[model samples]
Structures are given as C-alpha cells and as structure tokens.
Target: MNEPGGSGGAEGVRLQKVLAGAGLGSRRACEELIAQGRVQVDGEVVREQGMRVDPTTVVLHVDGMRVQLDPDLVTIALHKPKGVVSSMHDEKGRPDLSGLVADRRVFHVGRLDADSEGLLLLTNDGELAHRLAHPSYEVTKTYVVTVEGRVKPGVGQALKRGIELDDGPVRVDAYTVLETSPRRSLVQVDLHEGRNRIVRRMFDAVGHPVTRLVRTRIGPVRLGQLKPGQTRVVAGNELGALMAAVDL
Candidate 1:
C-alpha cells in the first residue's frame, strides 16, 4: 500500500496528492485548493503545490477546518424515495440525501432524478466514485420501469438494438417484460449509460413514455427489500463485488 505521502520519510507527501487521497477531489482540483491559499500547513496558508508536509506530524487544514486522513472508506446504499434529490442540497428547498445520511462528507455515486427512486450509492471515496460514474467502466444499472400502455414486442428489441436521442445513441444491455396490462406495463431494463433521465427518455423515444422508474440494481448490489427512504452500509462481499466491478 502506498503511504499517505509517497514513501514515508522526513519529507511529507505533495499537498495536492495528499488532499486527493483524502477524498477531497482529483489532483487538479486539489491544486486549485493550494493556489486559492485555502490549504494550510502548520497554520500557514500554502499556495504552492510543491510544498510537502508529513500528514502524521504536521498540522494540516483547509479553509480553517482541520484536515485529517480518513482511515475508514465508507460507502452506503440509500433507497432514495421519490421527491428526494440526489444532491446534498437543493436551492429550491427540496429534500436531499444529506438529510438521510449522517455523514455530509459522503456524496451520491451517481444521480437519481428527483422524481425517480431506488438504490443510490453514496461514498466518501472519491476515486471509487469517479470510476463508477465514468462511462468507460460500463457499470450496469438495472431499472424497473412502469410505462404507459402495454409495451409491444418490438419495443424491447428496439431498445436493445439502440435509439438515437438528442444527445447520442443509447441502448440497453438487456430488456425483460416482467408484467403487462392493458393500460400499463412493467419492464426491467438494464443499461450502463449514466445520462440524466436516460431511462425515461429512452422509453419516451420509443413512444412508451415511462410512468414510474425505480432503480433495482447497480453492478452486484441490489435494492432487495430495502424500502423507500431507507439506507444501509455497503460492506462484506457486496462491497468487495462493487470494488471488483470498478477494478479497485
């Protein structure tokens, strides 16, 4: 394992690298912290990126808040209920995940629209969050969608084949019809795309506008019996699977 500072020694690690490893953000973003003079070493503001200090011995602070190396990498699964935004704050006074989880430092891995609900992963591990959110990883996300009108046979195939939206072409890896009725139909669609409202828009593009959307799974983790407005820690083999999915 790499030490907090590259190779433990009298000289500390690079400030930006230390900050990034601490889950603050990417190295470039951490560099901005140093440039903004918000980073401090031993109570002195450090605007230079080259400056290094031992995390164990030297006192470090950012924006007047003490910066400590978080030893525990926390990741939690939240069954976000509808009407709750995926963000930490909503300027319009809408509910958000911050209220559900005690740790405000952790952020949602991806986003579920305010109107959509289901399994949402929140974590303080910035690197893991970045890998999971990136399109290249192709992390599978399964959704249980309820659409208006009974979906025709060809619709599922069409979705699997691919559809061109305003942004670009989108397609589902798998499509399954779980239930069907004259007025409504329930379908399970699996895809790796993480665009905003991609599932809803995909069905809408196929002329079957979605009535309700709920994410059932992400990678190896499932929503399972988790009820609305509930959260649980992701650990054990489940967390291991998630880490494996992203090649962590």
Candidate 2:
C-alpha cells in the first residue's frame, strides 16, 4: 500500500493517531485500515500513512460515512417536556433547554413551543444545525397529537392532499389516525416544514384543535424510550445518517 498524502503542513494530528484516538483501534490497526484505502479525508480516499489532518476543520469518512473527530462539536437529542421552551434562554423565567446543556456551547436546531414536547436537537456544529433546520433538506419530523373532538373521516386525506395555511400550502408526508373518542382523537403526522406552530395550525384548519402534542422522531433519530426531560448524545452510525440527510 502506498503512503497517504499530507495536508501539507506538520501542524495537525496524524490521521492514524487521530483515528485511534477516536476509538477505532490501536494506532497500528488504524494504520492498517488506512493502508487498505478505507479512510477518506475530506471526501478523498487516502492510503498508506503520514497524512496530517486538522480534525477541527477537515471532514473524515470511513466506508463513505462521516466520522466525528472533534470532541468539542456534539449533537444532543433532548426529550423536551411540556411547558419547557426549546431556546437556550427564556426571559420569561420558565424552564428552557439551556439548563440541559449548560456546560456546552450549543444552540437548539429548532424550536418546540412551550406547549409542545418531544425530540429536539441541540448542537454546536453550525453547518449541521443549519442544514437540518433548512426547509430544502426536508428532514421529516414526526409528532403524535391529541385533538379535540372525534376525528372525522377524510381529514387525513385532506391533509395529505394539502391544506392552504395562511402562510402557504401545507401537506403531510404521512398521517394516521391512531385513536378516537367522542371528546378527543389521537393521530400521528409527518412534516418537513417548521413554521411557527405549524402542526397546531394544521389541525385547527381541519376543525380539530390540538390538545396535546409530542414529537416522536426526526428523520432516523427517534425519541425512543426517553422520558420527558431526558437527553442523549447523538453519535455513531446514527450521527452519520443524520449528517447525510443534510448532505454534510
């Protein structure tokens, strides 16, 4: 196997050493992976050794999946509780996501209203956060909603077909009525847009105002078994898939 090219200066960490530090394996084992051309530095496959990369600025991938090398940059999935705001700071003095990651310099990717609850991501990686929240990426957000009154037939169809909100035409990627009673109905829906109170507005338009809302998933990451106010670091293969969603 031929030696890998350098990032030109001697200022950065060695690729194999960095890989080892990232828990891939012993330094020698990481070098073997490098020798086999399984390592990619900023999208280019590199082989052999002696390549130096700035983990802070350079992107690395093994087998076409992006790897996280910077310890400072992290993404967090927080199960926001009802009445908690998504912002890091709330002047109103209510509980907010800031207390959750007070030790890290992170910002929420999107907002979950004070009344809404469920999966919300916070990260210090600006590019990843921007892409994930951008409308063009269309990262679908899944939510379970309880609405007032029984859900009438064809409401799902009407939402699937698209409803014109005051902002514009809105449509759900998927919708299912989970349960219904005379006074309340439960349903789940998927959407990519993040307009202010979009889910609540959508239901209201259909004549069923949302009584309770809880997000369950965002793209491939699920809230899972996390209870209210719980949080987990988003890492490993799950992190890779998330970055891929935004073409990072």
Candidate 3:
C-alpha cells in the first residue's frame, strides 16, 4: 500500500535492497519478510512489493528491531590507552580521542580520564551516545583495579553494602577480589555510577588506594582481545544489543 501507484519508484531506494544491504539477509529473504508484514517504515508496516524509502529519513524496524541506515551515522569502540585524553580536541596538545578516529566526525560517548584506560566508545549518533552515557540509564561498567596492599573479602562485602562518599553514598553492583598479595591486590568491580574518579575515591576511602585501573566492559561491549590503542566499529549483534539496552 506504500507504493503509491508506482510513484515510489521515482524516488528513494527499494526497501528490500536497503534491508539486505543492512545485513538483514539476501534480497529475496528481505522481500519475504516484507511480504510477511514484518518490515516497518516510520512505524507503519509496509507489505507492498516495491515500497521505497529514504533510509536516512525513515525509521526502519524489522521484527521489532531497529535497522540503522544512515551512512553518516557511526559508533566506534576504542580501547583507549593511558595518557590519551578523551576529548576530541586538547588545548594542552596531548594525544586525544579525535586522533584515534580521524575518519569520523564523532565524540566520545563517555569520559575515560587520562590516567585510566579501557573500552571507550565514540559515536556520531547523538541519540545513541546520549542514551549510553546518561545516568538515568543503569548501564553497568566493569573495571579491573589494582590497589595498594591486599584487599580483604570484607572490603568487597562492604562495597556492596555501600560506602559513604563526600557527595553521597556510592555502591557497587558487583565486586570480586581477583588476586591478593602482601604488597598489592587485584579486583574486578562493576558499578553504574559515572561520578568523577569515583572508583578510585571509593577504594581510597576504604584504605586501599587504587594504584592502577582499567575499565574492561561497558554493558554489551567488551575489551576482549583488543589491545591498547586499537579500535573497531561497533555493529551487528553488539550494536543491536546496545540499542536494545537504551531503547533506541
């Protein structure tokens, strides 16, 4: 019904082609999905054989999942190394996030201070970036920390119970001691708080000052085998789960 008596042919690309190009499937398979009334454009199901859509301007959903088609939009995951600033431009002239993604006009989704490093995402998609970075969204981040002196099991328990900070009480969603020795300890922590230098401050407050910190995970994305100072495009299942996380 969206074909509009063949006027759709004069403008926009074919819907099935757009879907297939989006990695949904082959053209025939996308056509089958459209015929099954599972392809939607701007919230309306289109069952026409040759429905055309301006992908950049239309919200396309297949089987209730969004399909991003704007070629201008991108999201990149960077394993930021220590000493690199998260800002796109640094007046201090130190290496920055923009140099890492020189090809894309994007900004870092969240800040990873120069002292700490791990999975950092940069994106030109404003909505996706806002949703991922906003405090209203309870997206947990996992950090592996090394601190002075051995951390006891009690500290982990106390963290879960919540610790009082200058601003307010801070609590971890999860914490585990990965290693402990006489001089130093290693631990993994998960929290949703995005306050400035929060993890370090929390450990300091508990008497185990953090010596090293690396954020290992942010929601569905992982650092994995990505070495320091490397980046990969965020797409496919990972992208799907991310958008699903923030209701994009």
Candidate 4:
C-alpha cells in the first residue's frame, strides 16, 4: 500500500515498520500501540499488525491524533537549562526546552531530564532521532559532572569497567577524574548508552552523589561555549559529523 518514490519500499511495507521509522517507537512498541486501538490510517483505526501504507498518499494517526510526516527537516542544538523539561509541553505547566526555540514543530533528538542540563539536540528528522537515541547505535555522550565527594582512587577505572544498574550492566566508554580535591571533584564521563539517569546512577553506585551533571558532548557535537538557554542551528560540517558519528 505504498505510494511510489517513498524512501522505504513503497510497494509493500509493514505498518509498524513505517511508524517505527517515523520515530514513534521501536517496531515492537508500535505493534503494541496498534493493538491498544491507538493507531489509525486514513482516518480509520487500524489494529492489523501487517497493514501496509504508501508513504506518498497514506495518513497515519495515533490516539485519534494525526502524525504528520515532515518533508522539510530541521536540526538544532540547544544549551538546555536544568529546570526545563525536554518535552514540547508539560501538563504540570513547567517550562520546557520548546519555550526557547523558534521552531515549534521540532522534536528533541534525545531527551535530558528536567534537572539535567547541556547539549540537547532538537530536530524534526524522525529517522535520525531514532538512530541517535537507540542504544544499539551507541553514540558516545560526554558529560562533566561535579560530585559531592572526592572520587576515590581507581573510581574512574571502576566506571570504565562496569557499574551495576537496575536494568543491567553499564560501563563508560571513557571515565576520568579530571580535577580532584579534598571535598569535591570534576569528573568526565563518556558513555555510549543513553539509559535513563545513567550518569547520576553511576556516581551513586560509587557512593559519590552527583551534585551537578552537564552533558558537554554527544558524539561529534559539543555544547561548546553556548550559555544556558541559548540555541543555534546545526551547521553543515557539524551536522554531517553527527550523522557520520551515528553511521547514518
């Protein structure tokens, strides 16, 4: 049921695959959403897992809401502040990253918790967002953390080796106690996994609570000198570097 010239095969493609490629979720999750009567096509609720769509002509919906496919995509980087959530809106009426950007349609490539700050990416490219956010891609994220206690000797090594997370084993790609003193320290942690609350949990596992966590880099893109609440369009080479980093 595909219209000709769609990026994925237009002739025959599974509906869940299309939704997942559109960054709604993984294919399996999309199937569950479909089963729960949450997905629709061409204004009709579609529960069939194998339903086909022609990207050129078909319209998709989820939960009675249209999911428009973006033809003109934009990607931007924002220096997110700690208080802003990484969402378009918060029902509790809290401020979110969307308040700082001019493009209202852009979605975040990945999310930072409301209390986490630093290099947050905003984009309308669903496939790119999926690639960047998925754990299998293993895009390296770099964070500078100020901890409450001085890092014990070999703590960095311990982090690099592995830490026991609630989900499973997690390890940093690179870990270093950059600056250490009697009572506090600045630690640099690099990870390919984007697990929830990973950096904070890793530090907590080591008995050093994270006082502040700011992600300085994500793959080839860096937060740089951008002040909090500032944002900029991702330029040519920088954008290319990021895509390359994710093997897009």
Clashing pairs in 4: 1-54, 2-54, 3-54
Where model 2 places Cα greater than 4 Å from the true spot, the runs are: 1-5, 8-14, 25-38, 47-52
Error of 3 at 219 (Å): 1.7
> Candidate 1 — which residues are off by over 4 angstroms?
1-71
What is the full ranking by TM-score, best candidate first?
2, 3, 1, 4
lDDT by residue (1-248, candidate 3, tens digit) is 55422235468888899889988899999999999999777777889867777776777777767787876778888999999998999999999987788767888888888999899988889999999889988898999999999887699889999999999999999998889999999999999999999999999999999888999889888988888888999886677778877876
Question: How are the candidates ranked when ordered by lDDT, highest leading?
Answer: 2, 3, 1, 4
- Point out where model 4 deviates above 4 Å: 1-71
Q: Which residue window of length 10 is worst by lDDT in model 3?
A: 1-10
Candidates in order have lDDT scores of 0.84, 0.88, 0.87, 0.80
Q: 15-123, model 1: which lDDT tens digit per residue?
A: 7888887766899999998999887776677787776656656656666655545467688888999999988988889898889987557888989998899999998
RMSD of each: 11.7, 2.9, 3.0, 12.4
Which pairs clash inside model 1? none
* Position 41, candidate 1: lDDT: 72
Q: Who wins the lDDT comparison?
A: 2
Residue 155 in model 1: shift from native, Å? 0.7
Candidate 1 global CA lDDT score: 0.84
TM-scores of the models, in the given order?
0.72, 0.87, 0.86, 0.70
